[model samples]
Target: MRIAFASGKGGTGKTTVAVNLAVSAVRVGLGTAYVDCDVEEPNGHIYLEPEKDLSLPVAVEVPEIDESLCTVCGECGRICEFNAIAVLGDRVMVFPELCHGCGGCFLVCPVDAMKRSGRLVGRVETGVSKIAPCGEDRTAPGGEGEISFVQGILKVKEAMPLPVIREVKKHIPDRDIVIIDCPPGNSCPMVESVRGADRVILVTEPTPFGLNDLEIALKTVREMDIPVDIIMNRCDPDAELPAGAFDDGGARVIARIPESREIAEINSRGGLASLESPEFARIIDKILEKILRAAREARR
Candidate 1:
């Protein structure tokens, strides 16, 4: 099963939930993998800290102008939806950054003046935790664990991130479970990360901003026909359960992380919640149970 964790806004603790769930799953002896498909700002690595095993550039096909054979007919410019290509009387300009790598300019060139070239968008990196050191857990020393990790990192100031996100997802195979740390917001990048997911865990807080954004994210995920669950992070005992809108979505609340100084301190230092807070194990266990149940349903 492939599960994605997403949110409508940033700083909703989406990565925090994804990393912990993946860690908990690995501890349970499942063949699990974690894919940080949030190419724009992948932070799951700050927690997993897996050793690098593979790295590759994720490039897209952009139009390459052949000035010698060019007619400067505006056809290439007309066909480009992203305004990436422009043709003047004697000059052809190509904006690689603006290009979505659709290759429309190459196909629409009447004089065959447009060719294809690779434009580096981002990169995909894979790493191994405990699985690489030991073939099986029993043979390894005590306290050693296993988990696979992958992440997509977009180039600075690059507009197109879908290709990188797709490349990262290609690492995921049919497995017991794969946790995806998706980009926040209801944008194309977030959609790309959430696509093809069996289940999506929406992480949010009790604040008005959190609730409002959660609703927006739900609309997009619901359109994809993917099962969704909610995790109310930073839930304070003194505060009321501000999940009425979430309740209306009809998705189960798998977990609620109470606000505490220990969790805050650990989180500030980029620590894994599942590993740092022993008191939160009960909540993590319940969340893992729901995640496995969703996977089983997907199998059926």
Candidate 2:
């Protein structure tokens, strides 16, 4: 079963929930793998702290024009939808960054002047993290089990992150459960991260900005025909939602992590909030039960 934790915007404790859920799943004797798909700024490693075992570079194909074989034809430029190539009278320019690596320019070149070249976009790393059971120190020996970890690190200043996110997901182990820590937003990165998830949990605060983005993310996810559940992080009883925010959508609030300074402090110190907080652990356990139940039903 693949469960993805995502948020419409940053700082809603998306990664916090994802990491703890993976650990909690492992504590219950489930083989779990945590994949961080937020390639642009992946920080789940800070919590998992896995000892990496494999590192692979991810590259994308970009057009490399061979001037010697070039007729300076404008066919390549016209075929590129992203304007990655241009013909300037006597010269041809190829902008690798602008290219989507679709190889359209190569197919359109009449003289075969376009050569394929690779640009290093990012890298995928895989490792294992030993996580202790709930209420136990993770650093101590005799931990319950190990959680496989896979994450992507996109090269700085890279415009395209989908390729890196795809690479990270390719490393997902064949575990009983997989938890994806998605990028914060309703953009392509977040969508790509949760594309194949069996269930999606959107974490949001009670603020207006949080709810606003949540509605957008919820609608988008629903359009993709994926099952969605919302986790109200830092819940405030007095907080009010925007009108019709959750009315017709099948998405519902499945859990709420109430406002607590202790939760914040634990997470701030790079500790698993669920490991030390019994209340938090119980919440996670409930969510895990729901996920497992859904997965079993799907299997049936």
Candidate 3:
């Protein structure tokens, strides 16, 4: 099962929920992997601390123009919908950033002036890391069994996170389970992260901002034809979950975590949030149970 933990916006404890759930899965001896798809600001490494096993650069192919070729034909420019290649006067300028690496310009060029070259964007790192002990499983070995971890670190000032995100996901093993820590928001990055998951866990708070964005997030997931459930973070006692939050979205709340200062303090100290709070641990267990059940049903 590829479970993706995502949210409507940032700072709703998305990573906190993802890392904890993945750790819990590892404790149960499930062959698990965690992919931090939040390329722009991947933070799961801060928790998993996986030993670096391999690192590789990820790039996209863009058209490289050979000025020596005779014809400055406008064919390449017309075929490129991205406008990556522009023919002006007698010069053909290729914009690497705007290129989608489709290599259309190269294919359209009759004189073979256009060629494909790698435009380095980001790097993908894969490693192995053990989940920290949660105390619930006293017999569970610590640092004895490790789960695979992979993350994509977007190059600074790069705009294309989707390519890097796709490369990182390619590392997901064909196995029992994998948790994806997705980037926040209902935008393209979030969409790319949660695109093909067995289930998407939408983490949100109870505040008005949280509720509003939750609706948007649900819509995004629903459009992708994926089933999603909520993991309410900082479940405020005074604030009620919006009644119509899931109105037509087909999403429901699967777990709720009330505000806890202890969790906050532990997180601040770089400690695991879910393991430290058994209350939260129970909630995550429920989440895991739900995911496990869904996977079983899918197999049948």
Which of the predicted structures, 1 or 2, would earn the higher lDDT when compared with the native?
A: 2
Model 3 lDDT tens row, 1-300: 788888887899988888888877777667778899999999888888889889999999888888899398799999988878788988899899998777778777899998778989999999988656434554544433567899999999998898899899888776578899999888888998898898898899977787788889888888898888888888764444666546654777777787888888877776777667877777777888888987788779
RMSD of 1: 3.3
Which parts of model 1 are misplaced by more than 4 Å? 131-144, 237-249, 297-300
lDDT of 2 by residue, 192-272 (tens): 999999889999998888888899999888888888988888887444455676877587777788899999999998998
Error of 1 at 38 (Å): 1.7
Q: What is the C-alpha lDDT of each candidate?
A: 0.80, 0.87, 0.83
Candidate number that wins on TM-score, 1 or 2: 2
Native-referenced Cα lDDT, model 2: 0.87
Residue 191 accuracy (lDDT) in model 1: 91
Candidate that would win on lDDT = 2
In model 3, the Cα lDDT at residue 44 comes to: 89
- The better candidate by lDDT, 1 or 3, is 3
Worst 10 residues of 1 by lDDT: 131-140
> Best to worst by lDDT, what's the order?
2, 3, 1
If both were scored by TM-score, which would come out higher, candidate 2 or candidate 3? 2
- Displacement of residue 181 (Cα, Å) in model 3 is 0.9
